[model samples]
Target: MKKLISLIFTLTILVFQMNLYSQKIFPFEIKEHKLSNGLKVIVVPYNSPGIVAYYTVVRTGSRNEVEPGKTGFAHFFEHMMFRGTEKYSDVEYNRILKLLGADSNAWTSNDQTVYHIVASADALETIVDIESDRFKNLKYNKEQFQTEAGAILGEYNKSALNPFQILNEEMQKLAFTTHTYRHTTIGFLEDIKDMPNQYDYSLQFFDRYYRPEYCTIIVVGDVSFNKVIYLIEKYYGDWKRGSFEPNIPAEPEQKEERSKEVKYPNKTLPYLYIGYKVPAFDSKSKDVAALNVISELLFSETSELYQKLVLDEKLVDFISGEMPMDRDPSLFRIYTRVKDEKNVERVKQEIYNAIEKLKLEQVSPKKLADVLSNMKYSFLHSLDNADAIASTLAYYVSVTGNPYSLDEFYQTL
Candidate 1:
């Protein structure tokens, strides 16, 4: 334990130093700079030939929604961003992308909304200016706002058709009561239909959150980090920071374990999911690493229980578990598909027994090593994609305010 702690301390130091020497990162070089207005810039230089990916991560998501009856404003803005700016109309924006031979997409997660694009690096400046303009000065009126709100409602309708999304919305609502996580990011249908009534609030929302300080810009692939930084400074230097730090509520503790079942309109097979509150990601905490190891041993595919339950006996069609990562204690979710609802308790018992065995038995040496190795390979594989690497950095930055949680995580593992 002493050795492990010392190693963790040393790893933390290295990561800190690496980030500090932000003069110019090497081997997929990343240069971190803060604008006068507070937008964080991460420029990654790669020589992948023609293709480049530009990602803008806005640090506000559903977690930031705390107003009464305004559940999904963050996600709603994700739709509104495309409505248009004074300079770029909707058709013009789409046309420019087509002319530039670029494809663009954006998504809102629980903690952040990221706008991403890939094109020839020659179009980098245009993409940067367009994104900056949309973030800084958006143009939309009542008609556009209601139109997007209606579109979001349509999206919610489509998602409600999928039992998985429906149950997720139901499960999270049950798992959280006070925090905005209680509502699906798509929001309650009523609040969405009423979004137009809150158009003024929507404008305030944009001014309060969509600032340079709340955003991180990343450009990767076949680019010069030095040049990209200057370009960002030139185009986005004047962009302002958010006036108010989002007032996100902390979730209250779950006093007891909670379990729920959802029978969908299209139910054919039975699904069981259990959510147990778990500790958050504390890279410095050994106990967090232990929980990670515990989850891997219990539910990872190579584990004996998974083999017995899903591969050999076929009692379960599939099984998976997640310590739903968060800035606070999130749920450790156990998901399984069984023969029928009658088998739910039996499946639950088997999983509980597997967990119980951990207290009575330290995992086998091979199993423990396999679990760690699996995580290492997966983390390494994820770094191969430029977009994946950027988004991963953005998530850690948004969630923990420290991007090197990835390194400290491995040290604990």
Candidate 2:
């Protein structure tokens, strides 16, 4: 235990030195503004001439799903937004995207929904006009709503086919009680099945969560702040603010271990997943930073367990650890795929032993430095393009309302 504490002290010193060196080199000249309607816009000018990345981040997701019966609307809106506005039918929107040579997509998660497009810099005005129309004047009939609901159910069924997805669903259900995080972003199966009949409720959900106050528009690459801001204000100015605020219930502390078992009907390798409750994300917190490093220290491929169970003994086909940055307290999960059913018990013991070692002794300085350096360079390398940079900023913006939180996060490491 003293060795473990000493390791923590060493890691803290290393992180402090790294933070000092990084303080002088902030990555981007991020300019931010807020419209009267409470819509935020961030502009970053990069050297990539004649190309731009535009993003609309809605700060609502499964986390806003407080009602028991109306659970899936957060994800439902991801599909609904594509159904198009009164001015542009779904077919017309596709045609517009094709003509402009734009790359576009959207995704929903535990805390936010993001819609994005990459297109020629010259098409900025057209892109703004079309995207603004959908957010402000989106319109759909009951028939359209029902059709999308059916499609969502189909998607849930498809996900159920995957054993990993099944495990994740069960893990979430077992780990969380009162918190909406208990359900995946796809939401409860029953909620999705009944979504078709909740057309009116769908409209309410959009009105409550899709307001201007809950959204941010991020643009990076060959663009001027003046031009982007002017265009956004002109297009999104009339979008109204909302007064509703969701009182998301918090998950109580877990006092004992939780476990579940499953038997896939089809013959397949046995799988195991374990989750331990952790705190809500704070980019500057040392505890969160340590947990993030512990994930690497204990389970990363260079770690002792991976070398023994995966590459040497070959008892496991796959193994990984995840510590997600989330708006609420979440789980630190370990997953393993055992090659043979008979080896499952031994593999579980080995994993437990690895955790015990982590709690008892400190990781080597060499291993800590290597993992931290690799993670640093990995992030820097990912900034090779405008889309990548924009995507990275969108994530931080959703988490802390400031893209600079990315810097603060790495510094904490």
Candidate 3:
């Protein structure tokens, strides 16, 4: 009777997942259009009555910083973009944003830079005009550029003070040989210092990347798709496409495990990160899904490893794992903060043991089903607001150049 019950439960999960996969998970209808110059625009009309989220997803980041001595421009633009255009000075831009009651910010990652604005729905057209003008007409004199460069150096020095930052910087430097991922998004310390002197190179960098061909606009709110498209075309239509394409170097496979040690002067608990080279993210691949499940199974609080190392053995204060979604092959990393220096080796060995066990056995069907269900529920729950919806779609759009990729990704699970 117990066996029959288990079989019935397995069948039920299988049926539910099958039905879910056959349709889209995004509740709203996503409307899309591409300008003649290659700027992709996406709109999601939600029930929210008075607010909107605008995102300009630039499909360029430190990953495209492949040329020697040219790293960090992608991240630099995150600051430079706010310097404003000739038509709208920095002060005017700030004042306008304040008038509209908008919250705006931008961030650069390994594979993309995203600028977002959340404001009253009535201000959508003005927001569109300001964003379009800047992307096309961004201007900064050498003195202004140099001032920002100095600020970046100051920011970098401050970040260097953090042990966690130092560890992460060292880990990436050790992990990759030829890929741009070897450096942090902030680029090399030397390049950032030299940035002010490279005024000509700066213009070229913007010319190459700040083009319509490399950008996408996403708006989600209580809005109309037609009006959004019209406003986007009116403001951004004339932006020209550039012919430059960056040749990012492919990362070579690791033949042996790599290790690095950092001894910070500041006294703190020793932390360890063990990363295994993994394939690039593919939402349709079973291997990626299986790997994601394995990450949660081995390191989540519910895992036996966590119970042994933290709850009973008391070797670690915190332990977690991540398999980040990326456009290129990346790492599946396990991180731990150890309570005692002496227990570091023991904790590392236990992590290795967990990996070995996973290789030798399959996760039970019941457990796998539970994790997948929880993941789906969490994803659905995250889409509870306009900003959440736009941010979610922006991520998928950056990865696959299609917002519907989110639907396919969830269905794959």
How many residue pairs clash (N, CA or C atoms closer than 3 angstroms) in each of the candidate models, in the order given?
1, 0, 0
The local distance difference test score of model 2 is 0.86
Clashing pairs in 2: none
lDDT of 1 by residue, 1-413 (tens): 00122323433343343333223111254567888998888777766687788888888888878888887888998878887788888888889999998988888877788888888888888888888788777899988887787888888889887777877887888888887778877788888878868888898888888888788887778788777888899889887665797666778766665656666888567777777666677865655666666667778887778998899878898998775556666667788888776777888888877766655554555655667667777776777766677766777667666656656666656
**Model 3 compared with the native: what TM-score?**
0.93
Judge candidate 2 at residue 196 and give its lDDT.
88
lDDT of 2 by residue, 1-413 (tens): 01234334555665655556655123678899999999999999988899999999999989999988888888989988989887998889989999999999999999999999999999999999999999987899999999999999999999888889988988889889999899999999888888888999999999998889999999998999999999999999999999999999978767777677877776678898877777778888776777778778778888888999999999999799887889898888889999988988899889888777766665566766788887778788888888898999898889788877888888888
Instruction: Between candidates 2 and 3, name the one with more favorable lDDT.
Output: 2
Q: What order do candidates take by TM-score, descending?
A: 2, 3, 1
Candidates in order have lDDT scores of 0.75, 0.86, 0.85
Once fitted onto the true fold, the runs of candidate 1 whose alpha carbons sit more than 4 angstroms away are: 1-28, 261-263
Estimated TM-score for each candidate:
0.89, 0.95, 0.93
For model 3, residues 158-194, the per-residue Cα lDDT tens digits are 9988877888888888899898889999988999888
Candidate 3 stretches with Cα past 4 Å from truth are 1-22
